[model samples]
Target: MEYTYYPGCSLEASSRGYDESVRFVFNALGQKLIELEDWNCCGATSYMSTKETISLVISARNLALAEKYGRDIVAPCSACYTILYKTNHILKNNPIMKAKVNQALKKDNLEYNLSLNVRHPLEVLVNDFGIEKIVSKALIRLDGVKMAQYYGCQIVRPDRGLDDKENPQMMDSLFEALGAENIYFPMKVRCCGGMLMTTYPDVALKLNKEILECAYGNGAELIVTTCPLCHVNLEAYQDKINKKFKKDFHIPILFFTQVLGLALGGTPKELGLNRNLIPFQLKKTALEATK
Candidate 1:
């Protein structure tokens, strides 16, 4: 199971834990990831609204490289997953748009045939690795941890209907394999304001705060998400969220892969858990009760 790795930017730099643990887990599962060379940003949320062509071209370029290798590309970041998947899907559906995107690629001597299969890392794990394989490795049991799997859009919408759009169980299945309890919540696919953290931070913060509150209120001390944008907006905004709301909540925002990393017998450092802005403060009774 070898796939081209597209870390985008956030995972490589800010989400080192996501990047690190994903590598560790793939290796643990005997899967190889050949990271794309000279990859650039995937033009996240703003790309779709501001410059659609450039956004498609940027992601198309990344897929072009994947075609050169003739392997599927796995994007761990939610934004990268959505952007790349959108570009690939549209290019496959509209020939004229595909031609224009291909023409746009000529500037870099790249031509995209939409042959590259763009997949989210979560999809690869469930479809490629299989839940049985993950269940077989139960080193650290999370049986005590009742978790809420937060999808926050992207992975399960529009492009790939891999999981139940209304209710995704892939994350729950993985957590169940590790012996954790899955608390099903209807708000799994809700938006987390992504880059709006910069453009409209007040709204972003309010939204971010609500997300954590909702997750905790629903019986999850930890949130397992697949998007880098959501992770950034949710995790980095914790202090501001507490200050703004005048409350203290140390709910940990973890990548779905990071949870797998811990279950793979990797330490917090191996999983890049320490890089998080808010302490996952398990010392609190609310969190301690989960364990």
Candidate 2:
């Protein structure tokens, strides 16, 4: 199977590991991920809240490109998934909004008929490709590792319902398929403060502290997430959260695709595991455990 891939801005820079692991996993599974040609930003969360029309138009431009392929579009980032999916929802429901967006796109000689489906990579893995198939292709198993699946808020909210909104099992299922223990994390879908980390770090640190405490309390050695922002807030700000709470929290955050890539027998460098701020010894650890 093939689909149009949209990596968005974060994937190109801050979350390059996610982009690498996503491509590695899907390519290893024999699925083609055709990237959209010259795709632009997804207008993020702030743009949508400030300039709704501009946000819709920007996201629609990407949909227009994907429509050319006439295949489902898979977005790896939670923010990109939410923004693109929201554009699809709004354009399909409101004719006036659609007309305005189309009118703006006409200048660039583009039009979006809302003919494509926007899907998260996890949705494609669980809903499109069965978990059994993923497991069958796995060459490395995570038998002893305990992972906390963190979903954040974007991927399964408003209209982009990828799984059980409050209690998502999609990533947890993937974790189990790899033979990793999925910790009972109730705040899987909670907000990770997104850009609030830049605007109000104190508030963001407080929220992240709660998430860290929960994951650590549940006996999770690592936190696996699908969203880049959540990964950044959780992984990058652990020191801040620790300082604020006066405790030592050293949990390494990884993208789900990274775990899947590892299970598919890709080396740690191949999956960009070394790029993480917190060192993850999955290659030496998980491999030895399975052996």
TM-score of each: 0.92, 0.97
Model 2 regions more than 4 Å off: 159-161, 283-285, 288-291
Scored by CA lDDT, what does every candidate get?
0.82, 0.89
10 residues in a row with least lDDT, candidate 1: 281-290
lDDT of 2 by residue, 158-228 (tens): 74545777887888887787789898888888898999999998888888999989999999999999999
Looking at candidate 2, what is the lDDT of residue 125?
Answer: 86
Residues 1-291 of candidate 1 have per-residue lDDT tens digits of: 899999988887888888998999998888999999999888887777888777788878888878989889999887788888888888999999889888988998899876788888888998888988887864656656768789888788873769988788888887887777777566788888877788898988888888888887888878888887788888878888999999787878888878887767778788788888765532343234334
- Candidate 2 structure, TM-score to reference: 0.97
Steric collisions counted per model: 1, 0
Best by TM-score: 2
